[model samples]
Target: MEVWLNYVFGLRPRNFWGLVCIPLFPLLHGSYQHLTGNTQAFLLLGWFILMQGIHLFYVVTIATALISGVGAWLFGPPNSVGVGASGVIYGYLGFILMYGIVSGSWIALLLTLIIAVRDAWRITGNKYNESQLLPVERSPRMGWTAHLFGFIGGVLIALALSDMRLN
Candidate 1:
């Protein structure tokens, strides 16, 4: 329902939710620490996508979640509740990085590389990237697998999620 708001604005649904609110869909934190960290990374990444003004982001988001949910169900620990936007976030990262590589654009490639490097540094257990705009404190509880899978899913499902063709 909210997705249709993008059509009114002539943008992609995936871009809107994918970059902004969708990440929150999967992993909503209960503690201030949890929410703060996610919110910070989300805001920074969000600013990047917002500049692109693509609105049909919901498709990418929905697909990523569906795929990641399946991935989590298939591979995640038994009986564990999977909730967090990390999966979709990673999916976005995968999509952007792959897009840059496939398109051969230096800017896209460079940005993707930056994001990759940062995310990698963030992923290391018991370490945090000091330069990160998001929270510097690391949570050992975060799920790296979901992030990895989600990023892969984002690339895998980008086209299926997109509302319009570039051509």
Candidate 2:
């Protein structure tokens, strides 16, 4: 089931058939660990966005998934399949941080600060040590491209939404 789902839904870079995965990849995971890790962050960040507004939460999620997925599909390492919600989690983190700054919400700002302090390593792209890996062993590669694009997308979305409010 896992293999089948990944084959069908995982983002594959530069593959014409993989375009559908843009909106679906965030819903798939490579393993239990992947799913669990994403679940915690997704729920927490999603809750923060939800606290602002349910509509905003949905909009951010959809936009982030599309932007991040397209980024991964375009720039992911050749022959690699990207599967997991880490990209979306990163998107949520970006959205919360930027939204807080743009909206000047004290609660959002406080929460962002807490998350930043706690997940600084992750946000800064130092969460893994590739040098420690055995050359013979296979490990999932971090989707840094997705994370980068997702964060950018989140910030852009936050700015757009804030502008809409101002007008």
Give all candidates' CA lDDT scores.
0.53, 0.75
Per-model root-mean-square deviation over C-alphas: 10.3, 4.5
What does candidate 1's lDDT look like per residue over 52-132, in tens digits? 554635555566666665565455544333455666666666666665566555776788798887766544434343221
Q: Against the true structure, what is each candidate's TM-score?
A: 0.62, 0.86
List, residue by residue over 1-167, the lDDT tens digit for candidate 2: 99799988788889977777777788888779778878988888898788777888899999988888888788777887788777777788788778778877677677778988876766544426221111222235655777777888888889888743211
**Backbone clashes counted, model 1:** 18
Best by lDDT: 2
> For candidate 2, which ten residues in a row score worst on lDDT?
129-138
For candidate 1, what's the RMSD?
Answer: 10.3
lDDT of 1 at 15: 43
Q: Give me the runs in candidate 2 sitting further than 4 Å from their true place.
A: 125-140, 163-167
